[model samples]
Target: MEIGNKEDNRGYWDIVWNPPGERTGIFDVIKGTEFRIIYHDESQAEVSFTRTWDPSLEGKAVPLNIDKRFIILRGSSGFYTYGIYEHKEGWPDFGLEETRVAFKLRKDKFHYMALADNRQRIMPMPDDRLPPRGQQLAYPEAVLLVDPINPDLRGEVDDKYQYSCEDQYNNVHGWVSFDPPIGFWQITPSDESRTGGPLKQNLTSHVGPTMLAMFLSAHYAGGDLSPKFTDGEYWKKVHGPVFMYLNSSWDGSDPTMLWEDAKVQMMIEKESWPYVFALSEDFQKTEQRGCVSGRLLVRDRYIDDQDLYASGAYVGLALPGEAGSWQRECKGYQFWCRADVDGSFYIRNIVTGNYNLYAWVPGFIGDYKLDATLTIASGDDIYLGDLVYEPPRDGPTIWEIGVPDRSAAEFYVPDPNPNYVNRLYIDHPDRFRQYGLWERYAELYPDGDLVYTIDQSDYSTDWFYAQVNRRTDQNTYQPTTWQIKFNLDSVSPNSTYKFRVALASSTLAELQVLSKERKKDLAFSYLHPSFFLSNVITGNSSCMINVLAQVFFNDQDKGVPHFTTGLIGRDNAIARHGIHGLYWLFNIDVGSAWLVQGLNTIYLKQARSTSPFQGLMYDYLRLEGPCGC
Candidate 1:
């Protein structure tokens, strides 16, 4: 077959292999295949594929395009591209009789360890060419098309390194185009809109880049600059400007005016490049001063509510004696930051100074007391761990909502709305009387204490758990419910996790997880939610899996020693089948999306069953994982 054509009296062709089969492989064949090519000079040159597919094999190329020949191949050993040209008269390779083929090869540095779903593409292209048109430039061979309209000589492939061959690389030639910066730029004081710290080096969180290889990159790029080296190309040694570091931006509309020396000290100071910057007195003062940054965490009992101010509370940081006036006085409200849904907050870009942090909430009866003593210097980023409130809970008790008591089932909180939390269990509530009018549970606990609160629920699972008198009135059995709380933050992030909810009963009840968040996040609707599990439930055959466990389904089959009801005989009982009238278990999994930092409520509610006398009972809830869930 005709393989290549003349390009201004030059012939070119590039090859690629398959990927995803093996990191590297040896072809186990030799008998019949050969590379066949008919040249324009009415001459033929052939290379046999009869040998082991590798890089060491080299063969002569037909002198086509008048004075050039081609021998190109790739293998695990290394990539080889040879273009033998006439060395009738020359200095370098004057008798070597060749120029190199411009085809470029790239190595996949991290392919063996990557999973099939995670592996990247490997595509080879010609160094002196442009890639094929309309090709997505990523993977197997990620081609960078710099001057597409001008010329490109490399073809794009799905995976140029695939073991099978179906196409060839493209061919185009041109130089990358850009010019040196023009004119000049001056640093003028910007508007007050530029919000930053008291210092100029405080570039509002944009810090300097860090690396060491930059100063020696030119030597690394081409060793020809060294007297001991001579293999460097002539052009790389002759082109462009050089700097210890260079920062640039481009606008093709006027490439000539793209960049200029702004003369601004870019906050990129390095110990070795001290001579680069000459600062003024005011500029030096800014650099000498520092900033303070940290996260705020309250005691376990104190709810990290974001709208503390709206709730008649505020976290304050101020001078030590600022609040010691005849009347309590405080300043610097801008120094305060509210906590996030996760009870985490950050104070950024504060000028270095001494300060005290204190907070006051409506229900929490206390005067301002310093939670921390800050001594900040230039560029200081401080992080304070969990703060403990002295005597976390005290004074008269207050009730946020509902009747509070022990036991998982039968809660008194109403439904949750957007603004107000109806079912809230903040810390441990104590029974108290409010003004002798109504007796209520006081939501008083030491600050930062663990709190479990259910914010919403439907009435479907209620009467079954609440109607205790129904259990004795009717001959029919009543269903049961269990409510539990856990700190999801306790589970590490980016990990697999599993939990089991088990109930011991003479009969089985239809179990449902009541939390909307849990239903949407944790896998809950019957076992094997995904087809990846080897124990396929619906339509799955392959064993390769990426997802985690969808809950282990363990049914109760044998009779219990304590509550034995079913017959020991083989074929008599007609009541029990598929987890009915027995104790069963389901493993709940909260994959990756962890729980909030505080107390997270989990509810297990059971409904009425068809069994005659079997009563629904609660057993236990347990967590088992971070890895093998």
Candidate 2:
């Protein structure tokens, strides 16, 4: 089938048919009849073609062998184009035709029309013709082109819509509207887009795929992949010699060889100093002491020996490793042989402390002496110096000495027993009399356990105990006396015992009266005596008065008892025959005591009398031993 113009200059066409394969026998029978043409055009052109023939020469009015030709005028230019499309066998030969013409050439101006004879056959359509509005064209099933880089855009026109290169160029050129603004389209010198060129260099040297892959890995892993940069060592480790130049001359007047030799000597002396003498004093007396015993080997003999030693030298030493400050007991010292000699010596001791070492030889006005403060630990040998001693024109002799002071002693008091009573006697004879009485009573009944019978005979005023005067007027009641006794029978022999004694006025009214009179006394101003007893006994004995009573009374209250005048006594004792007046007694059998084998307590009591208004009534105490009756 042919659909478009064939040598038809008007750009119009018709369909004429010739079947693909020829038929024979009965099916090939006959065709020959009037035929008509049909066509369409974009410009509304009109045209037509027809034929009429008789087929009797083959005994059929429409003979199968009959063929015909017809013309379809297409345009006013008379240049109408048509197509011959064959639909069936010998259809063209049967005088059938179809034509098309541009609408510009037709008087009716209809853009599309159709014509045909009684036959039902229609003309074939050209593939290039535009479809009706909103109508889709049928496309081929197969794909033809493939692009690897942008495979999504590759295919036959039928399989995918063709994207116009013009549109792509316009979008890239910033001429057409795009949802996202177009970026710069970098071009090469040749005026072509540079999409295929290498991408811009990464400022951080992160450009290539490998670098990108590494970066992605680091980001995902959350750490750097490269090794960290570092400076290996932090602290410097120093060792070897420490060369200290003392009076060394800066000018070349002192040979370099001499200085170098001296430095080496200093190192040798530092090392050998400890072996010779452990202390500086040992080195100062002898040449074989400390490092001085080592030979002095001079490297520069040509240099003046006097100049080498006298040119304001420096002292130095070699250490095994880094050395800390010297410690206690150890010291460093140095001595030079002579001011003009080329040799000097150093002494290092394991002992530490401040030290001074000196060499005092005749004819040498300058004594080589060095004083060093050092604290050396055990096993430490410190180098002191290659001291250079210059001779003074004249001055006092420099002597080295070591003087150490003695350490103080440590003393502490041990615990004391609380049961033994201590007493002191002051200046008055009356006070001594009373105190001696108490003492005698304790000696007789030393076990501190004693009992007393208080009756008319015991109440005599003669031989009563009294105390002397004290300093203050307020407490000027004669001598201050205390009578304390303990029950030793209740206490074990050689065992410690404690007791406490307290004195209080028998009545508040009496205490007030006494306090009024003794308020100005020195004894009254001080704390009242509270006696404690601590003692160990040796044998069975009864309660005994172990403490003496003394008085410190002022001149104004001369011969008066320093304590308040009142009846003093311990509870739980035998009743005493006396006026309803105040009475004083010490009971030994009442309180607790610790007794051991062969030790017993003696019971005893001594009495004395005093009155706030009357002053001292008695001046003596009567002491009695344990009853053997």
The most accurate candidate by lDDT is 1
- The segments of candidate 1 whose C-alpha lies over 4 angstroms from its true place after superposition are 1-295, 300-316, 322-334, 361-368, 390-392, 395-629
Candidate 2 stretches with Cα past 4 Å from truth are 1-493, 506-543, 546-607, 610-629
Per-candidate count of clashing residue pairs (backbone under 3 Å): 31, 96
lDDT of 2: 0.21
Candidate 1 lDDT over 1-629, as tens digits, reads 01232342221222111122222322211122334332223222223221122223312221111111222222111111111111111112101111111211111111111001112122222321234442433232223334333242232222111111000100111111133322111111211111110110111000011001010110100111111111321110100001122223355443222221212221222111211121212112344543343333334223443323223233444445422110111111124434444334455444356766654332332224454577767767667654433323211121122111111133332221222111111121311100110001112211221123333333223212111111322344334333444443354565544444333222322344232322232322323111112221100111111111222122122121111112111110011110111122333454434344455444433343333322332323344445422
Q: TM-score of model 2 relative to the true fold? A: 0.12
For candidate 2, lDDT tens digit of each residue in 1-629? 01222334222222121222222112121222444333345533323332233333322222222222222233311121221212223222222111111111111111111110111111111221223211222223112222212233232121111111111111111010021211111110110111100110000100000000000011100111111112321111101111111123234442223323333433443444332221212212223223322112222222224423332122222111111111000111212222234444443332332333333222222123344433434444455434444432111211111110010001011111122111111222112211112223223333432232223123222112211122223433222322222222222233223211112112111111121123342222222112211122111232222221212212235444333323222210011100111112111111123233343332212222232222121211221222210
